[model samples]
Target: MSRAPGQFTVVAPGRVNLIGEHTDYNDGFVLPQAIERGLRIAVCRRPGSRALLASDRGGPPLDIDLGAPLLAGRTDWGRYVAGVVAGFQRLGWTIPGFEARITADLPSGGGLSSSAALEVGIATVVETLAGQALDPVAKALLCQHAEHEFAGVPCGIMDQFAVTLARRDHALFIDCRSREVAHVPLGTEVAVLVIDSGVKHALGDGGYAARRRDCETAARLLGRKALRDVSSIEWPSLEHRLREQEGRRARHVITENDRVLAFKAAAEAGDWPAAGRLMRASHASLRDDFEVSCRELDLICDAVGRLDGVFGCRMTGGGFGGCAVALVDGPRASSIEALARTACAAALGHAPEVFLTTGVPGARVE
Candidate 1:
């Protein structure tokens, strides 16, 4: 594709949580990796102070006023773009009008964080045009704020951090409270399998917010700053003080945080079995305590977990519905995929979309 003098192309990958879920907002640890699938944007500067945005996915074109103080646009996806633009302006960058065309392979609502990809991709585009880069952590926080203020999702930082800082052949381990990061190597001996359940989840739909509220209430009752402050040792003593639902919510976060640390250690030691076991346990906690797993997700995890050569399987996202990720022996990935397809089809009356991916670099201009 030919481009104008100031034109640039930026790509941002989606992410799958390896162990941690819903813990970011509570200032806990999370392990996630950026997948090969993501959003691609071809963009260039335009003359006027308006953004002309188009998507290959068949949405009406969005025309956004860049000069306006409030840049939230009319469409759901447009809000992500506008939010990014607003973020750059907040940083005192003078943004001119731009035209962007977006194409994405990332599945939206599958809990793979397509929204973060869009936000980060657009942020990269702005940075590219300005010939400067924001500090990686600051850039990630900018995108996270966009999701909170514009998208109204009140998301944690895991998705944005994964999409912004992930390194190839590794998973990004983030301590959300401290903003410290380490890249855990994911060698080529295993494959990462993502199976989409075909059931979509929208976090804006109160379920996610309700869970966050529960955690906050739990923290308040325990007299802690956030759930992260409530250590596993303290959990047993404090669990009974909260209501039933709040107790469950606090239990999930406290334990899930511990699982993230254990999972990272297992990954570093190349102990696939231990890592897989942690994944399974993490899923169970999300289902029973966090209350996010759906029937389809549970079915996929159960079928895939039972297969030969599979280390473990679990639901990998926000969890009401989306995808399950499995770590399996690379040599047997194809056969496991086939068997998983047939088994899930027989039980659910249809086969799901399954694919394998490796960790890749985060958002950048190509």
Candidate 2:
């Protein structure tokens, strides 16, 4: 396709939760980094108040009426784009009609926040056309709201925040409740290996919402505003008061929050082993307590964790099969990947997509 006269591109990175899982919605802490793989959107203004959207992923072009009400029964990807447009309208920003073509290396439903990358990338496109930049936090929140209101997912601030505000060569330490952020350097000693298990997770399934509901019920039962209010020291005494499932949900959030802080400390001190241990523990909590892991995720984590040069391995993302992340010694990364591929292929009949990635800057116009 020929470029429009004033066309520009926006790039947004997908993120991997290095440790904390499912704790974001509980108003807890999370440590995540934006990975180098993500979406690229080439966009330019059009003549009228309608938006035309297309993707290299092969779908009919989505033409959205900017002035019309959001259709309840639009296609999944279309809903995401329209959601962002609705968000911009809600903010009183006058968005012009535009044509955007999205191409991405990020794997959708692999728990790398491809959906957030798309939303943020489109929002950035709108922001660029509007001739003003929003505060980073507000930009992230706007995308988050799009997910909640349009995508119908009750996600926490972590994914959008990391995708919008992440710095290169750093992990974002986010206090989901306060919206405070700290950039922790991911030094040169360790490498982050992300393994796609080939199992896609659709959070729109009731599994995700069910877990969130359990956490809320647990908090109400414990007389706390949210699980974040319940300290680690206080959890044991309160654990027995709730039913088995609710208690487990609450336990995961409380302990995961603690692990996020400890992992931050380990990262700051350049302690890869300590950070790896925390990653393993976080995966266990998500698997046993949060009940989000599937056999593919468990098998991959177990196989990778047993390998040499791998500091730690665990299932990442919203679970039920997406990806696993490992912290490995930088020098042994290639060997580790080879061994992991052989082992996983032997067991699963096919090798997974395993690659090394580092922290990269968040969404921006190019």
> What TM-score would each prediction reach against the true structure?
0.97, 0.97
Q: Tell me the lDDT of candidate 2.
A: 0.90
lDDT of 1 by residue, 242-333 (tens): 99999999999999999999999998998999999999999999999999999999988898888888898999878789999999988888
Could you tell me the lDDT of residue 204 within candidate 1?
A: 86
The TM-score measured for candidate 2 stands at: 0.97
What range of 10 consecutive residues in model 2 has the weakest lDDT sum? 67-76
Q: Which runs in model 1 stand beyond 4 Å of their true positions? A: 1-4, 71-75
Ten-residue segment with the worst summed lDDT in candidate 1? 68-77
lDDT of 2 by residue, 185-247 (tens): 988788899999999999988899899999999999899899999999988888899999899
* Model 1, residue pairs in steric clash: none
